[model samples]
Target chain A: MKIALAQISPILQDVRKNINRHLKLAEKAKKERADLIVFPELSLTGYTLQDLVPEAAINPNKDDSFDAFRLISKEISIVLGFVEEKGKGSFYNSAAFISGGEVLHIHRKVFLPTYGMFDEAKFFSQGKDISAFQTPFGKTGLLICYDFLNYGANYVLFSQGADIIIALSAAPGRGINENDAFASSHMWELMGETVSRFSTAFVIYCNRVGFEDGKSFAGGSFIYSPEGTAICRASYIDEDFLIEELDLSLLRKARQKLMYKRDNKPEVILKNLYRAVFKNED
Target chain B: MKINTVFVERILTKFIKDELGKFHFKKAVLGLSGGLDSSVTAFLCAKAIGAENVLAIIMPYGESIKKDISDAKKVVKQLGINSKTIHINPMVDAYYSKYPIQNRVIKGNKMARERMSILYDFSSREKAMVIGTSNKTELLLGYGTIHGDMASGINPIGDLYKTQVRQLGKHLGIPEEILKKSPSAGFWPGQTDEKEIGIDYENIDNILYQIVDLRKQKKEVAAMGFSQKTIDRLVEMIKNSEFKRKLPLIPKISERTVGHDFLLPYDWGK
Candidate 1:
C-alpha cells in the first residue's frame, strides 16, 4: 500500500479555504497513485479556533463541504481531520476514513487536552470509544491528536486485529534542546516507534505546519515501519507531502517476532482498568 | 534549551505575522534600548511585519549613555526601519525636579516609566502596539520596573532568557559590540544589570532552567551545584515577581470571581 502524508498549513477559522487546499493536495496525491492520503488534525480549520470552532465545524451527515472528498475517495482513500458538529452546541475533534465514495469511520478525539496550550475541553466533546474497523486496506484504527499519548488507544486497536494505525496531530514544536532540535518531535518519534514495534502495525503520523494564534505547529509527519524503523519523515516547520510504499508482508513477520499483541490478556487489562478507575467500587 | 537562530527566526517571524494579522494590525512599535533584548525584538519585528511597518523609537534621558543611543541608531540604520529620536529628558526631569527624589531606585523607576510612556505615545500615533523587550531572566528576577518595561501589546522575546537572547542576537548577526556589552537599563549613570541584581545572567539562567523549566526542587537545584543562598534568592525573586507575569489578583468573594473561577480568556468569544 502506498500512503501519502499531506502536511499542510490550514487557514485559521476558514473552513472553505482549508477544504479547497485539501482538495488540491488530495488531487495531487491521487495523480501520484497513492492508495490513501492523510491530513493533519483539524485540517479543515486551524487549531486554536476558540469560539470560532462552531462556525468552522461540519456535520458529516449533512454538511455539503465534504462532497468533494467523498467524490475523490472513489479512486483514493482519504483520512482527514475536521471539527465535527454533531448538532448545535456539540462539537468534537474528529477524523474520518473515506473510501469508495463512502464514509467508513469517524473517530472523535477521546483525549481532549485541557492543560498547557490546549483548551479543547472548553470547545470540544470527548470521544468515548477506541476500536478498529474494516477498511479497504484491511483492519485500521484512527485517532486524533493527543490520543497517542497513552497506551490504550493503540493497544485496544491492535488487540482488535488492526493492521494500520493512523493519527492526526496539530502539536506545536517546543523546547529546543542543546542540539537546537524540537524535544516534542523527539517524543513523537519515540511514540511512533514504540507503538509500531509493540503493536506490529504500520504507524502513520500527520502533523500540521505553520502558525495559529501565535503557536507554530511542527510538521514532522512520517511513517514508521512495522519493525519500528522510520521509513520516511518530513522536516519540522515546513509543509510537505510524503509518500512511501508499505510492505504488508513485514507486518506478519513483525507480529511473529514480537508476539506482544498475540499474548492477549483482555481480562487482565479489564481488571487493571477496574483497579485504576474503580478503586472505590472494589 | 538552545535553538537554531534561522529556524527560530522563521517560526517567530511567522508567528508575529500571523498573530498581528489576526488582530488586524499592520504595524509594530517598540522602544529601541540599544541593549541585546531590545535589539533582538526590533530585528524580529522588522523581519516579521516588515521594516516599513516597524517603528523604532529611541527614548533617551538626559543622563542616558551616549553609546546606547549610538547603538540604537545603528540598529535602525542597519535594518532600514523607520525611527524617531524622542528626548525624554524634559518629561522625566520635570517630575523629579518637583519630587526632589534622592534614591537611585526611585529615579530608575521614573526613567523606565518615562520611556514606556514615550513608546505608548508613538504606539498611539503610529497605530501600533508597544512591543516589549524584557527577556525571561529579567522577568523572572523582577528586575524590570512593573508597568514600565513589562508593558507590551505583544512580546516575542519574553520567553527567551538573557543567554538565549545573546544566542539569538548572534544568530541574527547583531553587531558584536552590542551583543557583548554588559546589559544596562541606562536609567542612571554607570548602572549595570549584574551590579544591581548582584548576580550574573549565566548563573541566574542556569538556576532558573533547573527550578522553573526543569521543575526541580530546591534540594535538587542545590545538588546541581548552586549555592543555597543563590537558590533561595532566585526562588524568592521568582515567587515575588509572579504578579508581574500575570493579571492582577481578584480575590474571590462572590460566586464568580474575575481572572479566577469565572475566567474567560481572550479567545473565549462572546
Candidate 2:
C-alpha cells in the first residue's frame, strides 16, 4: 500500500485557511495514488489556541468543516487533525480518519503535554482509550503528539492488529540545542526506533513545518519500514509530500523474528524498570 | 560589575541538585556544540548536578568545522565534566545522500536535525534528561527547531534573555572565549545567526524585552526610537510564530490531561 505523509504549514486560528490547505494536500496525496495521507496534530487550527480553543472548536459530524476532506478521502484515507466538540461544554483535540467519504473514526489525543510553553491542559481534554481505524489499506492506529513519547497505549493498538501507525504532531521548541532547529527530526528518529522495535509495522509521522507560535517546526516527515529503515523522508523547513510503498509482508517477517512481546511482560522486570526509574510514590 | 560567583553558584546548585533534584533523575545530558548556547548550558548542568552526574556529547558533522571541536573541548576542560565527541559526519552525509538536498538553507537545517539525532541517542543510552539551551530572545523570535533543538526534558535558560544569558555566563564564571565569541548556530562555518536573521543580538535583545515579555505595542516600541521596520518584524515574528509556544494540541476526549484538562506541572506530584 502507498501512504503519503503531508507535512503542511497551517495558519493559526484560521480554520478556513487550514481546511483549504488540508484539501489541497489531500488532493496532492490523491494525485500520487496514496492509499492514506497523514497530517500534523491540530493542523486545522494551529496548536497554540489556549483560551481561543473554544472559538476554534468544530464538530466533525455537524461543523461542515470536514466535508471537503470527507469527499477527498473517497480517493484515499485521510488522517487530518482538528478540534472536535465532545459534550455540551467540553472538546477534544482529535484526528479524524476519513475513508470513502465518511468519517470512519476519531482518535482524541491521549497525552496533553503542559510543561514549559505548552498550555494544552488549559484548553483541551485527554482521550482515554487507544483507537484503531479500519481502512481499505489496513488496521491503522492514530495518535497525536505527546502520546508519541508514550508507547504503552500505542502498543495496545498494535496488539489489536493495527498494521500501520500514523502519528500527527506539532512539536515546538528546540531540543538540547540553542534554537528550535533540530529537535523535531531527532524526536522522529526516536519515534521510529520505538515504533519499529515494538510493533514492527509501517510507521508514518507527519509534522507541521514553519513557525507557528514562536516555535519553528522542522517538517522531516517520513515513513519507517518495519525493519526500522527510513523508506522516504520529506524536506525540512518547507511543505512537502512523501509518498512511498509499504510492504505488509515485511511487518509479518519482522514480527516473527522479534523475541520480546508486549503481551508477555515479566511482572518482576516490569516492576523493576518502573520502580528503579520512578522510585517511591506508588 | 563584580561577578558574585559564589552567590550565583549557590542558587544554581539549589535549583539543579536540590530543587530539580527532587526528581532523582539518573543523569542529565547536554549537547555541547562548543557554541555559546551549549557551553553555557553545559556549565549550568555541571554546576546544577556535579560533573559526574552530567553527560556532555560533542556532536559535530562535516560542516561543524575544527574550531567547534576545540571550543567544545575547552569548555569540557574548564568544567571538568564527563564528555565524549561523536562525529555525525558519516550518518548525516549518508542521510543527505539518500535524500539529496541542494539549498544551503535546507542543508543547514538537516545538519541541525542530524546533530540532534545523535544527542537523543546519547540521552537515551545514558538515561539522562535533555537540558535546553534556548534563551528568551531565540524563543520569542521562533529561532529554534521543533523537536530537534527544542524538545528537551527541561529548560533552565529558557526564561533568560540574550543579554541576561551573557550576564549569567559571566556570573557562572564560564570561559572567556565562550563568553566572548560571536554567537552562531554553527550550521555553516561562515554563517552566523545575526547574518542570517539580519539583526544583531544587542538590538534584538533590547527590542524583544520591550515588546514580547513586556507586552509593549508597536507605537510604544516606535516611541523608543527603534525603526518601524524592526518593530514591525519583531511583532510579526511574535504574533505569527505563536504556535511555537505550545504542545502539539490534542483534541480533548478525557476528563483530565496535561494540555487540555488537568493543566498540572510534570512534577506536580512533588
Candidate 3:
C-alpha cells in the first residue's frame, strides 16, 4: 500500500484556502497512485487558532465545508484534520478518514494539551473514544498530536487489532538537540519507533510545517515499519509531500517473530488500572 | 546548552522568511549597531530573503564609537546588502537641549527611541518589516529599553541566548573584531553591557539557562555554583521589567477583555 504524507502549511484560520489546498494535494497524491493521503493535526484551520477556533469549526456531518474532501475521496482516500463542531458550543480538534465519498471514521483528539505553549483545552473538548476501524489497507486507527504521546492511547488501538496507526501532529519545532534535530521531533521519532516496534503496526506520522506567531511546526513526517525502522521521512522545518510504499506483509512477519500481540496481557494491565483507580475500596 | 549552529541557522532563516512572508513582506530593515546580535541578524536576514532585499540602517549617536561604525560598515560590505547611515545625534541632542536632562539614562533612552523611529521610517520607505535583534539573555533579564530597541515587527533571535548568538555569529563568519568585542548598548562612550548588568554574559547566560530554561529553583541554581545574590538580582530584574515584556495592562472591564478573555494568536486572520 502506498501512503502519501502531506506535510503542508495550512493558512491560519482560512478554511476555504486550506480546503482548496487539500484538494490540490489529494489530486497530486492520486496521480501518484497513492492508496491514502494523510495530513497533520488541524490541517484545515492551521495550528494556533486560539480565538479563531469556533469560527473555523464546521459540522462535518451537516456542513458543506467538507464536500470538497468527500468529492476528492472518490479518487483517493484522505485522512485530514479540522475543527469539528459537534453541537452549538462544543468543538473538538478532529481528524476524519474519508474514502469512497463517505466519512469512514472520525477521531476527536483525546488529549487537549493545556500546558506551556499549548492552549487546546481552552477551546476544545476532549474526545472519549479510542477504537480501530476497517479500511482498504487494513484495520486502521487515528491519534492526534498529544494523543500519540499517551501509551494507553496507542495500546488501546493496537489491542483492538489495528494494523496501521496514523498519527497527525502540528508540533512546534523546539530545542536544538545534539544531533541537529528539533528536540520535539526527536521525541516524536522515539515514540513512533517504540510504538511501531511494540504494537507491530505501521506508524504513519504526518506533522505540519510553517510558522504561526513565530512558532514553527517541525515537519519531520515519517513512516515507521512494524520492525521499528523508519522507511521514509519528510524534511524538518519545511513543507514536503512524502510518498512511500508500505509492504503489508512486514506486519505479519513482525507479529510472527515478536508474538507480542499473540502473548499480550491487556487483562493484567486492566486489573492494575482498576486497582490503582480504586485503591481505597481494596 | 551547546546549540547546533547549522540547524539554528536553517530554522532562523526559515523563521525570518516565513514570518515576513505572512505579512506579504519580501524585504527587512534593522538597525545595525555593530554588535554581535545585530550583525548575526543581518546575516540571517540577508540569507533568508536575498541580500538585496535586506537593508541595514546604522543609526549612530554622537557618542557612538568609531570602531563600531566601521564594524557596521564591514558587515554591510561583507553581506553586500543595502546600507544607510543616519546620525541620531541631531534629533536626540535637540530633544535634550530643549529639556536639558543631565541624566545619561534619560539621554541614552532618547537616542534608542530616535534610532527606533528612524528604523520604522526606513521600514515604510522600503516597504519592509523591522526585524528585532534582542537576544534571549537581554530579553529575559529585561536589560533593554521598553518600546525602544525592543520594538520590532518580528524577532528571529529573541529565543537564542547571547552566548548562543555568539556561537551563531561564529558560524555565520561574522567579523572577528565584532564577535570578540565587549557587549554594549552604545548608550555612552565607554559603556558596556557587563558593567551595567554587573555580570558577564557567560555567567549571566548560564544562570539564566539554569533558572529559566531548566526551571531550576534559586536553591538549585545556587547548587550549580551561581551566587544566590546574583540569582536574586537577575530574578528581581526579570520580575520588575515583566511589564516591558507584555502589552499594556488592560483591566478586565468587559466580559471579553482584550488581553484577558479575548486572547488571539498574533497571526490571527492572516
Candidate 4:
C-alpha cells in the first residue's frame, strides 16, 4: 500500500492554522492515491507550546479539529499529532492512528526530553503502554517522537507481531554544514540506525520544520526500508512528502530472520527470578 | 549593571571552556562586530580560554563605519587576542549580484547565513569552534537567522539578556564605542535592531529576563507596570522561535531520544 509521509511546517501555537495545514496535506496525499498519510508530532498544536499547552490541549472525544482528520480518514487513513489532557493537570503529547472515519489508536509520547532546548517532562507525563493495532494495510505499531529511543520498545512491538512501525517525531536538531568543524550529527545518526536494525519493518519518520521560539528544526524526514536503507528523504527547511509502496512480503522475511533467537535465552530465567523474588503468600 | 565577578570567573567562563573542552576543542572563534553582543562574546572567550587562544575576526563590509572597524581592532588589542581583518564587501557583493534577492528578509537572512558560512570555514581552518554572539533577548525573539549569525558551535552569551550582555561588556573592559553603540545585526545598510523590532534593548531584556528567565507569566509581566502589548509581543516572539533552540529531527525508533526520543546531555558519559 502507498503511504504518504507528511513532513509539515507547523506554526508555533497556532493550532487552527496547523490543523488546516494538516488537512491540506492530507488532501494532497489522497490526490496522489495514498492509502495512509501521517503527519509530524504535535501537528495540530505545534511543538514548543510551552505553558500555552494547558490552553491548547484537546480532549480528542470532544475535539472538532480532529473531525477534519476523521472525515478524511474515510477515504485515506491519516495520523496526526495533538495534545491529550488527562487527570486534571497532566497531559500527553500524542498521535492518533485514524482509518475508515474512526480513530483506531492513540500513542502518547513515552520519552520526554528535559534538557537543552526541551522540557517536555515539565509539561507532559510519560506514556506507559505501547500500542499494536490491526489495520487494512498491516499490523502497525505506534510511537511518539522519543519512544523510538527505547530499542526494547521496538522489540516488544516487533515480537508482538507488528508489520509496520510508524514513528511520529518532532525531532529537534541543527543542520550540518559541509565545512563546519564540529561533527554534531552523532545522536541523529545513532537513532536512525537503531530504528532500521531492530524493527526490520517499514519505519516512517515524520518531522516538523521552521523556527519556533529560539529553536530551529532540522527537517530531514525520511523512510527506512526493511533492509535499513533510506528509500526516501524529505527536503530540509520546508514541507514535503515521500509517498511509497510497502510490500508485507519483505516484513515476513525480516521476522523469519530473527525467529531463531526469539525463544532462546534470558526471559525464562528472568520470569523465575521475578517469581522467586516476589512470591505472594497471601 | 552590576554582575557577580565570582560567577563570571568560576561558573560562566569555566563552563564555557569546559563545554568546548568536552568536544576536544581548544580554541573559540568570534566574528567581533564591534557591537555589544560580539564584544561581550570576545571578552568571555578570552577569559574562558586565554587571550592567545581566542581568535577574533574583524569582518567589515564596504558600507561599515570606519569607527566600528577601529573599535573592533581596539577590542582585540585590549583583549590581546589573535586577530584578523577579512574584508567581506567583495564576497558579499559578488554573491548578491549573482543571486539578486528581492525580498529584504530573505536577503538579510542569506547574508547572515553567509557570514556564518565564512565563520565556520575559518573555524575549521583555524581548528577552533565558532562562538555565538546572540543574547537571550535575540534568541527569544527570533531576532537572528538560522545557520547564519544564529548558528554556533558554542554560545557563551546566549543565556545573558542584551542588557546583561552590556553589563558583561563593561566587566570585560569592552571599549565604550562598542558598549554604547546601538544594537544592530549589521545585516543591511541602515538597519538598527531596535528600529526593526520596534522595541528597545533595555525593555526587551527586562521583559525577557522576567518572563523567560524568571518564569513569570504574561500577566505577571503586565502587573510589573509594562504595557500589555509589550508582554504579548515578547511572549509571542519567545513562542515563535522555540524551534531555533533544538536539535534536528531524529525519527523515534528507540524508547528514548536526545529530543522527543530520549533525554540526556551529550556529555553524559555512557
Candidate 5:
C-alpha cells in the first residue's frame, strides 16, 4: 500500500486554520497517489489544551470539523488525532480512522502522561480498552503518544490480531545527541524499531512539528517494516509529507520467521498483573 | 525569585545532565564570575555532570576586584572541580591599544566579549560546552553584553531570575559572602549591576515576571505599582537587545532560505 505521513504544525486552539492546513496537505498527498495519509496526535487541535480543551473540543459525531477530512477520505484513507467530547464535561485524547468518507473506528488514548511537561491526565479521561478494528488496509490498531510508549499497549494490540499499528504522537523535540539535534526523536525511532521487530507488524508513527508554549514538537514521523527496518522517515521540525510504498507481505514473512505472537502466554502475564495489584489477597 | 530553590536545583541538574548526556558530552565549561548567577550555574553543573567534569575558568580583567577572584577560587575549592585562571587584561589591552575607544561602557563591553572569546577557546580545547550564566532578568533587560557572557552552548540558569539565583545559591551551599555581595560584572572598580541599570533587581524581577511570564501589558504592569517610566525603560531595553537572543540574520534570497525556510535544529540522530 502507498502511505503518506503528513508532518504538520497545527496552530494552537485554532481549528479553522488547522482544517485548512489539513486540506492543503491532503491535496498534496493525493497528487502523489497515496492510498493512506496519517497525521500526528492532536493534529486538529494543538497539544497544549488546558482550559482551552472545552473551547477546542470536537464531537466527531456532530461536529463539521471532520467534513474536510471526510471529503479527503473519499479519495484516500486518513488517520488523525483530536479532542473527542464524549458527553457534557467528558473528553478524551483520541484518534479516528476514516476511509471511504466514513468513520471506521475511534481509539482513545489509554495512557495519559502526567509527568514533566505532559498533563494529559489532568484534562482527558483515560481509555479502558485496547482493540484493533477492521479497516480497508488491515486489522489496524491506533495509539496516541503515551500509549505507544508503553510496551504492553502494543502487545495488547498485536494479540488482538492487528496487522498494522498507527501511533499518533505530539512528542516534543528535545536533547542534542551529538550528531542529531533531536535526541528524543531518536529515542522514539528506537522504540519504533523495537516494537516493529517484536510484533512483526507494520508500524506507522506520525508526530507533529511546531513550537507550542516554547516547547518544539519533533516531526520525525517514520514507518518501519516487519523486519524492524525503517522504510521511510519524514523531516524533523518541519511541515512536510513523506510518501512511501509499504509492503504488507513482509508481515507474514517476518512472523513466520519469529512467531512471538503465537508463543506469547497471556495467562502468565495476567496472573502476574493480578498478583501485582492484589499482593496479599492473591 | 520566590520559587522553591531545592526543586529548581533538582530539575535544573537533571536537565543539564540529560542534555549533556544526549549530546555525548561528559564535561561542561563556564566563566566563574563569583557572582550569584555563575555561582548558581557552577553548583548545578557540578551536581549534574560531576565536580570532576565541570571546568570553572576564572577570567579576571585589569580592574577586576581581588575579593571576587578569591570568591571564585573558594567555589572551585569547595566543588573540587577543574579550575583555570586566565587574566584577560593582555587581550583587552591589545585591541584597544591599536584602536582606542573613549567610552568606558564601550570598553567594558569589549572586556566582556574578550571573556567570551577566552571561554569559547577553552571550551574547544577541553571539549566542554560553554555554560551561560546570565539569568532571565539580565537576559530580558539586555543587561549583559551580547555574544559575550550571554553566549553558551546550553544554559542551565538562563531561565532563573536574579532573586531565584540567590535562593539557588543558598540551596547549593554557595558562600554567604558571595551571595550577600552586590552583583557586579567587575568591568571596572566599584562597578555594580544595579548602579549601571539604575533599578534594583527586586523591582526588576517583579516587573519582568509580570511582563514575560504573566504576559501582562505595559499599562497593566504599570498599574501593578511600578512607575510608567521604569516600565517603558525596561520594555525599551528588551526591544533593543532582541537581536542578541537570536542567531545571526540570514538574507532570504532563495526560496529555501537558511534561517527562514531551511532551519536545521541539529536534531538528525543516527
Candidate 6:
C-alpha cells in the first residue's frame, strides 16, 4: 500500500483556508495512486490555538465543516487532525480516519503537554481510550504527538495485533543536537525505530512545518519499516509531501524473525499492573 | 552551549520572512548600531526578503563613537540595503538643556528613546516593520532600557545569547571589525556593555543557560564553579526587571481581565 505523508503548514485560526490546502494536497496524493494520506497533528486547525480553540473546533459527528474531507475520502483514505468539540466547552485534540465516505475511527490525544512551550492541557480535555481500529490494509493504531512518548500507548496497540502505527505531530524544532538535527526530531526517530522493531509493524510518522508565533515546527516526517529502518523521509523546517510504498510481506518476515508478538505476555503484564495500581500484595 | 550556525541562520531568516508575511509586510526597518546583534539581524532580514526591502537607520548622538558609525555604514554598503543617518544630538540636547539633567543614565536613556521614536516614524514612512536587535543576554539581565531599545514589531535574535549571536555573525560572513569589536550600547563616548554589566558575555550567557535554560538553582549553579556573588547579582537583576519582560499588570476585578485571564496568542485571527 502506498501512503502519502502530507507535511503541511496550517494557517492559524483559519479552518476554511486549512481545509482548502488539505483538499489540494489530497488531490495530488490521489493522482500518485496513494491508498492513504496522513497529515500532521492539528493539520486542520493548526497548533498553538490557545483561546481560539472553541472557534476553530468542529463536532466531527455532525459538523458540516468535514463534508469536503468525507467527499474526498470516497476515492482514498485520509487521516487528518483537528480540534473536536464533543460537548459544551469540551474540546479534544483529535485525529479522524475517513474512508469510503465515512468516519472510520477517531483518536483523541491522551497526553497533552502542559509544560515548557506547550499549553495543550489548558485548552483541551484529556482523551480516555486507546485502541487499534480496522483499516483496509491492516489493523492500525493512531497516536498524536506526545502520546507516542508514552510506551504504554504503543504497547496497547501492538497487543491488539496492530500491523501499522501512525504517529502524527506538530513538534517544534528546538535544541540543536550534536549531529546538527533538531533534538526533538532525533528523539522522535529513535521512538519510531524502537516501536516499529519490537512491534514488527510499519511506523509512519508525519510532522508539520512552518512557524506559529516564532515556534518553528520540525518537519522531518518519515516511514520506518517493520525491520526498524527508515525507508523514506522528508526534510526539516520545510513543507513537503512524501509518498512511499509499504510491502505487507515485510511485516510477516519481521514478526517471524523477532517473535515478539508471538511470545508477548500481555495477560501477565496486566496482572502486575493491576496489583501495582491497587497496591495489592503478591 | 554551541549552536549549529548554519541551521540557526536558515531558521532565523525563515522566521523573519514568515513573521513579516503574516501581517502582509514585505519590508523591514531596523536601527543598525554597528554591533553584532543588529548587523546579524540586518543580514537575516536582507536574506529573508531582499536587500532592497530592508532599511537600516543609523541614528547617532554627539558622543557616539565615529568608528561605530563607519562600521554601520560599511554594513549597509556591503548588504546593498537602503540607509539613512539621523543625528539625535539636537533632539537629545534640547531636552537636556531644558531639564538640566546631569545623570548620564537618564541622558543615555533619552538618546535610546529618541532613536526608537525615529525608527517608528520611519517604520510608517517606509511601510516596514521595526525589527529589534536586543540579544538574550541583555534581555535576561535587564541591561536595556525598557520601551527604548527593547521595543520592536518583531525580534529574530531575542532568544539567542550574545555569544551565539557572534557565532551566527561569523556564519553570515559579517565584516571582521564588527565581529571583533567590544559590544557597546553607545550611551557615552567609551561605554561598553561589560563595563556596565560587570561581567563578560561568555560568563553571563553560561550562567543564564544554567539558570534559565537548564533550570539549575542558584546553589547548583554556584557548585558548577560560577561565582556565587555574580549569580546572586544576576538573579537579583532578573527578579527586579520581571515587569519589563511582561505587559503591564492589571488588577483582577472582572471575570476575565486582559493580561490576567484573557489569554490569546499574538498571531490570533491572522
lDDT of each: 0.85, 0.74, 0.91, 0.74, 0.83, 0.91
TM-scores of the candidates in the order shown? 0.89, 0.52, 0.98, 0.53, 0.56, 0.98
Give the DockQ (2 decimals) of all models: 0.31, 0.02, 0.79, 0.03, 0.03, 0.65
Candidate number of the best lDDT: 3
The weakest ten consecutive residues by lDDT in model 6 chain A span: A175-184
In model 1, residue pairs whose N, Cα or C atoms come closer than 3 Å (at least 3 residues apart or on different chains), thus clashing, are none
TM-score (C-alpha) between model 1 and the true structure: 0.89
**Fnat per predicted structure, each in turn:** 0.26, 0.00, 0.84, 0.00, 0.00, 0.60
Per-residue lDDT tens digits for candidate 2, residues A118-165, read: 767767888887877678877888888788778776666666667788
Model 5, residue B214: displacement in angstroms?
A: 29
Tens-place lDDT digits, model 2, residues B1-270:
222334333434434553345466757888888777777778888877788888888888764478878888998888888888877778778988999878876776776677677777877788777787887787888777766677776676676677667877887777788787777766678877678667788888778877755578878988988888987887788777678778878888877666765532333212
Q: C-alpha displacement of B123 in model 6, angstroms? A: 1.0
Docking class for model 4 is incorrect
How much DockQ does model 2 earn? 0.02
Which ten residues in a row are the worst by lDDT in model 4 chain A? A175-184
Per-residue alpha-carbon lDDT of model 3 for B1-270, expressed as tens digits?
789999999999988988888889999999999989999999999999999999999988774489999999999999999999988777877777788978888787877888889889888988999999999988987878888999999999999999899999999999999999998877788898889878898999999998898888999999988889999999998899899899999888887888898878888756
Estimate, for each residue in A158-248, the C-alpha lDDT of model 6 and write its tens digit: 9999999999899998886334568888999999999999999999999999999889999999999998999988989988999899998
What are the runs in model 1 whose C-alpha is more than 4 Å off?
Answer: A51-56, A253-258, A261-282, B24-26, B49-53, B97-100, B127-129, B249-270
Between prediction 2 and prediction 6, the one with superior lDDT is: 6
- Give the per-residue lDDT of model 3 (tens digit) for A1-282: 898999999989999999999999999999999989999999999989888889999899899988888888988999999999997889999999999899999999999999998989988999999889999999999999999999999999989999999999999988775557798898999999999999999999999988888888989999999989999889998889999999999999999898889988899988988888889535
